[model samples]
Target: MDVRISKRRTTGQMSVFELDALREAFRRSVRENNVTEVQWAEHAERFVKSMIRKESRGIQA
Candidate 1:
């Protein structure tokens, strides 16, 4: 599947509470799925490339 992320910039940092929540979610995902950082990064790279290819073909995301 193709994934597209917005290029707009946000001004503020995440609150500590929000950061903790995200960290916990990530930990749970990793623990449950046995995912490594490298695998996650590679998957993200492939997803972006797919999105770019689809975009070049004039396909709406």
Candidate 2:
């Protein structure tokens, strides 16, 4: 299966509250389920489709 992975980096001083919120969400997700070992090839396919759909909707709006 064809696959694509996109990565990005942002450089800035993030607020403490924003950082804490992100950390909390990650902790919650990990506590809820073990997502570390799943096969992600299919997930990537769905992710790309979802992003495209969202972008098209934003454009239409």
Candidate 3:
């Protein structure tokens, strides 16, 4: 699977540590499922959005 991180406008920038964590999460997802590329992308997008929302709300994600 090709895992690419696109540069886009977000509520805030993620630190290197956060990005690494996200990458690991994606890898775990891949390991647990046989998802298509599109599905993987969607999953990643949702995860990122949730993270941003949680941060904005001052909650742990």
TM, every model: 0.41, 0.40, 0.48
Identify the leading candidate in terms of TM-score. 3
**How much lDDT does each candidate structure score?**
0.57, 0.52, 0.67
Clashing pairs in 1: none
RMSD of each: 9.0, 11.3, 9.8
Q: Which stretches of candidate 3 lie over 4 Å from their true place?
A: 1-13, 29-38, 59-61
What digit string (tens of lDDT, one per residue) describes model 3 on residues 1-61? 2122223233345568878987897788767776677697787787679766876585332
Report the lDDT of model 3 for residue 61. 21
User: For all candidates, what are the clash counts?
Assistant: 0, 0, 0
Worst 10 residues of 1 by lDDT: 1-10
lDDT of 2 at 23: 60
Poorest lDDT segment (10 consecutive residues) of candidate 3: 1-10
Top candidate (lDDT): 3
Candidate 2 per-residue lDDT over residues 1-61, each given as its tens digit: 1121111112334467856865675555555654453634554455457655875696466
